[model samples]
Target chain A: MDSIIFLRPTRGLAALNLRDLWVYRELVYFLMWRDLKVRYKQTLLGASWAILQPVVQMVIFTLLFGGVANLSSEGVPYPVFNFTALLPWGLFSKALSDAGRALVNNRNMITKVYFPRLVIPVSSVLAGLVDFAIAFGVLVLIIIYYHFAPGANFDFHFTPALLTLPLFLILALVSALGFSLWLSAMNVIYRDVGHVLPFLTQIWFFITPIVYSSSEISSKWQWLYALNPMTGVIEGFRWAILGTQSTPALLLIISTLVAVVVLISGLFYFRRMERSFADEI
Target chain B: MDDIAIRVENISKSYRIGTAPERYRTLRDSITNAGRHILAARHLAARLSAGRSDLARSPDPSSHSTIWALKDVSFDVRRGQVLGIVGRNGAGKSTLLKILSRVTEPSTGQAEIHGRVGSLLEVGTGFHPELTGRENIYLNGAILGMKRVEIERKFDEIVEFSEVGQFIDTPVKRYSSGMYLRLAFAVAAHLEPEILVVDEVLAVGDAEFQRKCLGKMSDVAQAGRTVLFVSHNMSAILRLTEETLVLEKGRLAYRAATPEAVDYYMAAGFSDAGERLWQASEVPADAAPFQPLALRVRDPKGRVVDTARSTEPLSIEVEYRLDQPITGLRVGIYLLTMRGEYVFTSFDTDDPGKFEQHSTRPAGHYVSRCTLPANWLNEGRYVLAVNASAFHVKRYFWDDHALAFNVDATGAPGKHWPEPRLGPVRPALDWMIETL
Candidate 1:
């Protein structure tokens, strides 16, 4: 028997069994592809829903937060700034909801056949990325529109830090997947987990600096705010694409650590609870 | 030993079932229980060390806690084998399959399946009613671990087998039940996984479709692949598989050849034997006039019995409490084979002279016997579920679980069992081995 390894501050966190996941990667890809096709199959807009989600949200944030609330867009245009952050954030939100209920939603599959239970949530997270890419295309178009097509002072240019955008996106993916694993496993046993997910997401949005700039927050509470994990991801995106000076470096470091902690613990909790899912669901 | 495609070590799964409280517990109860398991563990240990039994007790007290499913189970299946799992409902057959598929992990032990697995636990699994048949086919195939290329290669065959044709592009919600079952089974069967796990979803299809599926499963098994099939249909189990495992109430009750295992499963009656004969809460007051007061199946001596050879004289004795004497009454015993096949019906009207006027005061019991001559039934597990009607079938009483019995084979096995082979009648036959 292998030695017990705990992945959390609290004891009894089960092993993640990473080797099994590696073996089932092909299955994981197929499941993700299946989810992507089915999600868009009969929808009226097809893939357009992806571009529309963040684009609509960007318009709302630019009007409400930038206009009435006077939230700073740093030196960048509010539309471009909000769209970039919302692109990844929207993907994270979709992943959270989809992965959170993947097990319960597929009750027939869960009770009848056997496959790695982890595959369900992981595939949900992966499938949401396709939507993120579609939304990202819209963000680029909006950036060009504001910078060059109109009478605007903004100059669109790529920087070396643009490469880190993928890393930040990866961080957000892990963060959503981590929380989703816990939610999906819990949703199988207690349906209330699903009922509370929307409220949870609403509160989580406030904690992440998705709407207002993180620069407005005082430094004393930066470490605490960074505990939200998504803080680092959103701030990093605004910094990379919008070229914001106040990137909240200290908050990004602390939130990265926090995200890692939540992810590892979430995965362990999920894997431990996974064994009973089929029976109970 | 041949390649062990699947190895199941001793595994047990238990569910902690808690009744819904009359009212949700207050925050105080939550804090108390959480504190006991976490915050008080060290203090409770100290209290135990100090010899204070009451203070040292653990908390999170659960009322009437019981395990709802599964006990130690172990088995192995070689490559290129089709193993049938047969049991009544709630017998843990599905639970075992879920464990093997790793959709759920075993509670106590481990199961190692060596190859890719594709499972069809029920018809239309992983299908969204809003999704077209074509979309569902891909979703189900992916869920079964099949790549797009693999599904593409078998796509035409699947469509042909299901006979969905133009309807394949339509959402499955509009499809008939037969079409839904066909498409679901076709995707699962054609997925080309090394190991195929199927439940009794095919039984939902039409007779011709069910036959086609059974034939396909036979072909798959013959191609040196592994299969784990779970079904309540004994004939399907016996026809498609060589090895069988029987589970009863989450435990491995028996395992052997297909026929013997199915026989054991059938012999174990479906109803819970421990339940009381009469439940006041279960009986409906609306069934007052035609209530089933008593039920019994017996031999000539009137002793209750449930097993007999095909040639033995047998009878079903149904005793009913009639509120009033009624004429033109029809008392019939429906003979159903274990596979739910209706063999034949025997009614009192078959013998016109058997009816006689007999009255009793107020409410009283009456016995109606259904007698069958020797060698009438085929050799199989038969149930004597009975029903009665009055006033030319105006209305009556029906008891689904009246009684069930098994009819053993009295015939010989045509030199297979080293005994004299009897004819289909199971009665004395004259020999004809003369000058010819």
Candidate 2:
């Protein structure tokens, strides 16, 4: 039998209801499935749009920076170098925007039903993983084409570091979800978060070492760059996939710490603001 | 104590009025407001330090802006009891449900539930237009707090109940509106939670579906689950709930068996006196020169009564004080059934002769009375709304369903049938039946 439950106005800092979330885990999965299906439904291009987004960005970046500006690719082909970073960068930006708008878009559900509210933004971030996987497939083909192309001169090596790719992908997921939690909660109250999100993702894209290599930044500022969380994710992806640069252990550690802080604080803020969502939204 | 499935104690919810509805203050607005508050606090501190007593005597500023949507409302429901909640719009019925469902937090007190709660505050709440009907059933089921296994077990029953078996795989956007409503309601009806909370969502479906929903509710009640049903349809309430609660201005006005509570609510009107007396504070400032003094239903002997026998004439009287002369002003009354079906609207000047005589009366106090002849109304609760408006110009004051009364059929025609008749009016039509 279910035990008695008492409800009252929560006070002080709001505690995350992990048990409630566990019970409603199926809702999270279903919501994620809905987002994935709806994203490709009725569209002419369908899932191909996912592969196209990152591939198109890689082509433009390789042209503008590698071909036109004569920027160095650290002995790796510029296309392979930029494409590796763009894989994680694409996931970060897409997940951020999608999860940020999740709450306001589902105001009907939020106001009308009772579930773990965290499922909304969390599912949005999880839904982006499907697109990320599709885009990742294209990156692998690009790597293979460059490896076997005549006179490619690409010295690609697979190392044990490839096994750590999932860890870095999870890191990217955490950072995106953390930021989205804050943005989605604020979007319910301010509504300006929706308007500011695109601009935010654009500015975030430049600072994450996607278009250019992180080596160009002075070693002194590298620690500050790691504070962005995605810095470590992008650099970690390149090291794991292309074996371009040695792993930045210090940067990865700092980024992981920063990601944890963001996630913890974002969860608290989201739960704190959740009580007013139905009333405000 | 163990028999009680739900207990609510002093649950109150207050909302800040005179602000943008459902809009939160933007970050910039909050920053500016905080800055102003801090500056004001500092100024007050300086005055206090200077030994000025006046500065310390002011009340808290926030209290003036808030309005209580529910005030110290307390109630309980035993296991297997189906309770109906009836109230006028904005009487905090929805707020109470939101608080109970945990969609929103109450401002004060607590509600304790002894079992799992499933609330259908709205049907099709999380249905995605792009998703197929099958997918939406599972999605909506989970949204209503049903477990995945439970939804899976009930999937076939839900589809059959919805009568959408052919379109189960098709996206709901392709389904007609009736099919959509049916599918949504089917998912909600199949949820077997220990307690169910429903709002006024049944009115969305057609009449047949409504009867089906009421039947399902009774089934749930018979199965020993507690239910909280809020609706404006009194007949449904009468049919389903054993006991009912009446809310008046956010307070629990009456709680009794369904029939008695419905009777009390119908006759209560804006006050317990079966009359609506507009106090100075209750009237909006803009309704100047058109202040309604009082409104009441009087028996044939000219005494205020909440319930009138259908066999006699009943008079509805509205008294108003106009501070200035007004032209083309018509004071009217609208009679409607308890289910919000309109019976008729009659203006004091509806007769052209009266309209011509009162075209432009000078400033004075006046009373407008309209009488309904005997045998004109059915045996049921009816609502009366008063309006003051001009022809095609502007409406000064309008209250929809502002007052309510009951018309009892004690001596009306066909009282021996023992079954209630339908429709707003139940007039006796003479019939001659020969042995032919």
Candidate 3:
């Protein structure tokens, strides 16, 4: 009653149909809500898994790097340093793995009705924010523990840099969304892409400087190192939260460019593959 | 043009089955196939340069790789009209609906809709097992393109209709399959779009629930909305639809008033080989002594055919050769409807005196036949199973589905009635209205 709809066979380079996404925004919200509700269902510990996964990893890394390897945490305690990086890393990594399976997982909805297929992976990537938010609370508690603990060697102050946290958080989200789009769409055609995701994320984790400081790397390779989008996000996130040395502005620009390019290209690739999803799925 | 709700123009779809199909294709297979394609293309190029006539004249490789599930189908639905789609399996009914609903893009041509279209290719499409019944209602409503506030307004009606109000807060995975179907159809029925395209969703669900759904669909159609219904239930098609389209093998075979279309579609599937000649290999070694020869379906006019009008009598005659003397041999035919539901079984010796005292049979050529009276069978395909045996004696031979035929009951008694007849037989019983 509102408007006419025309459906035609597409040849090449179809538009993203951003209007359909806007109209079906409610379904997106419901799917995201569904994922969040179902994630903790039937679990004895509930949302604690989000907190437990990162905290346990932080303890392991702290004992291995700070005590045995004698790595420098700059001025911050090793636990806070590693935990800060873990928060954004957790967000990115969860977004990757979850979105990789999101299309194949929600194939029931995809083949049955007509909606923007982009909604599935987008909502899947967004659902990780809930887990990240819960895990973030632990980071704040750890920061407080170091601040007020008796005989603590670390100094804690409210720096002006704290205001930059939201910006870096947005960057981390953008990077996750960008990479997730590639994985979820390709996962539809080549199913083995899912098998490779674990190894891909594992290698991606080591290169992002989560457990080690970026200063440990040789200065000559900085440009090549900054090619990784997460390096910018994780480094920027650490600087904002812990008041570590600020990342070079050039490195931040390169990382943001990579994130934006991946996002735009992922959108293009996703739109290209979306028309065949119903048949393939 | 203004009153037209949907206009489909020459739409077609083809699916490319790359290499062979699996649940999902792996990278190793795809990469290797890509390498093979490159080599194949190079070979083709070399052949073309040498002017190989056959290679130059071959059809496009892309066309050979894809199968056209639907081909050049077009139709239009006027506003406020309920149109039914009838087809046998693999007839492309589901494919056409999927195309119009935009579940997949067509390989060619296009369709235009002048109003909002809500298609239910399946019920309970987006329901999650972990979600409670109440939550799934909201999720399913949103998935069907209903606003949250719209679902909130109809929430109680949906719950009441599903009859799961007592267990609304429970997870749907815990609900029985019947309860799940009821809840799923209840949500889909409430989607009040201007054009509703439903695909045989009523085929599941219990009779009471199906009646409820039909009643609701009648309400939807009566409210001046366009509806496209695809179903194998002929009675439902006759009851709800004004016009119908018949598809055969991805092509539009017929379009007419609902009854006429149903008749044409039912009669079109004449199961071939109606007169089956038994070969030596088909018969088992244990029944070597009794050689079943031939079976044929003959119309009332004594002409052989694979299909006949329902109002006409049809006969089944089976011929055979008995190699040796067999005592108490009774050759019979089992008349079954398409789904293996038996209409009746008749033997040459069903008559009490054992067919004029021919109890003991001598070895020679023998023929046994039975005639189904006019106006007896409903319009559908029926399979014939043959048997040769004697009560309390040795079983000689048996052949399941020895032959098949079809019948058309366009003018069966009570044709004016809306409700469906329950069984395979349509008896023309005598009825009269008496003044009290």
Candidate 4:
């Protein structure tokens, strides 16, 4: 075990020590476990609250946007369309806020010990999965509940298309991790990112086609709308689960491209700022 | 060369306070000054506003932008050598440890280590009170750079040493503070890496716990592992380390056997013997509510002197002015030896009646004095450090380098024999030489 480790100042995006990140994968798992463990202290209320939050949001959107504004859900009842989008959207938003604050919240570990700094934010992003799984179960129940009721007719069968559900879920996480990487790193130097996060998430929610189907948006701006990666994630989730009318090939292509680009750039930006974190944070 | 466990070559670190939290950056500032000005421009603006009036004011004394925490410091430690590092506060001791642990990068140069490294900057660096003692051991072990198998292998020993086996599953929040420190330290002690970087771990805990830590550290040293130990506890250094490095003002001041290094390090704090004073400019801004003014030593003759006789009581006095009323303030002195080992500590309000009478000290000029009994100290040099702080609250001022004085043993017990005194204190004993 005589590994001669070398130390020096990192420069110019050369600090992306993915090997270091890989070496401490156990720490990554432990941190993720700790977050999950400490998060839900009261077991029943914790899981219930996780499902309760999205169900309440789905109801509000169905009543306000679905009923009052006469927004089209492509003939599917408003609740199923809205909740389907809410799953990925909820997962994405949680990653944005939670991952963004992970570094600042663990300043003790940063200033004290040596580990791959990326593990902190990355673990929080992944830990959002547990909450996502809880809410997803509720979404399935909502789908079945609406199917048997009057005037609400969508199915919840295990289709070959449902195989793509995990893919869209992964896509939502990729897009979140992208934006989160930038926000968390910058949050270390300038705390302005923390204050700006809520407002940005609010606007992002309106931009993504969460309340209404992507078919309602005018074609001229659809490409620009897909620039926000969550648009494709929400749209893709509806098609994969609900098997919505049209295939969103163009939307998927644009959204995936943007998410991959942001993730790569965010990775570079994070590594560049990684060296100063211990001192600056 | 092959036996060297760590090789640090010309390592240095410089911190720009501009980026640190001290120079808080708001969103408005970042937006308005986005690219046109970041560090350089704003620094110039700050200087221009401070003006040119105070020419005699010290330049770059910590607040003026840049500080080099370590300067061209280099060293090598053989595979089984335990090295001690001693320094005054801000002497770059902790910064050096930070660099070697890879917690931060050096601004210049590099270091190579040929073994698994474990750093204990503080006991329980990431212990969550919500976590059980058993769980915290695993979590804390992982954070301290221990592998999963390592923690699993040593789990039993850790619980046994901590002596909290019965309560291992209880949340550490419920543990007494003493129990908490014990459990945290237990995990750290069980780390059996080839190399260790420890910082003042003995500084916490009670006297018994400190002794236990000293015992554990000696065991580590005796086990033939390379260790870099930094501490202000001179006695512990003398006991555990064979060699020591002395750091002064961010530079390597001296290096030698532990005894010599400790003596030099302790004596280096002396600027004068009879009296020490701090000027208005010398006092740190944070010490505003209470500022240290002066410390003086006087002989039995009532004359301020640098040297005192062991046969007569000596008086030590501290003078200061408090700008505001304070509660629970304890103005105390720590008496130590030339090797920096503690003799005893005394506070002006240590007496219960005195503490009750002066529970709240009003703002004004004050003088606190105490006397050391005659025939109490042996012939040697000693150091006194002053502290003014409220319990568990704000620390107004502290000066470890406040004063150093000499004590002479004369006309005491066994004066006719002319034998050298053996320990820190010299006590007069009543003797009866009857044929019994």
Candidate number of the best DockQ: 4
True contacts kept of each: 0.32, 0.84, 0.87, 0.75
Please give, for residues B175-198, the per-residue lDDT of candidate 2 as tens digits: 999999999999999988899999
lDDT of each: 0.73, 0.87, 0.86, 0.86
Candidate 3: docking tier: medium
**Accuracy of chain B in candidate 2 (TM-score):** 0.71
Chain B TM-scores, listed for every candidate in order, come to 0.68, 0.71, 0.65, 0.89
What are the DockQ scores of the candidates, in order? Answer: 0.19, 0.65, 0.59, 0.73
> lDDT, candidate 3, residue B167?
97
Per-residue lDDT over A145-165 for candidate 3, one digit per residue giving the tens place of the 0 to 100 score = 999898777777788888988
By lDDT, is 2 or 4 better?
2
Off by over 4 Å in 3: B32-63, B271-436
Q: Give the distance in Å from residue B45's predicted Cα in candidate 4 to where it truly belongs.
A: 22
Give the runs in model 4 whose Cα sits over 4 Å from its true position. Answer: A42-44, A156-158, B18-23, B27-64, B280-284, B433-436
lDDT (10s digit) by residue, model 3, range B246-359: 998798889999988977765565448568898886686668578899989999888888887778888899899999877778899988764344678889998879765877
Interface RMSD score of each model:
7.2, 1.1, 1.1, 1.4
TM-score of chain A of each: 0.92, 0.98, 0.97, 0.95
What order do you get sorting by DockQ, best first? 4, 2, 3, 1
Candidate 4 has which clashing residue pairs, if any?
none
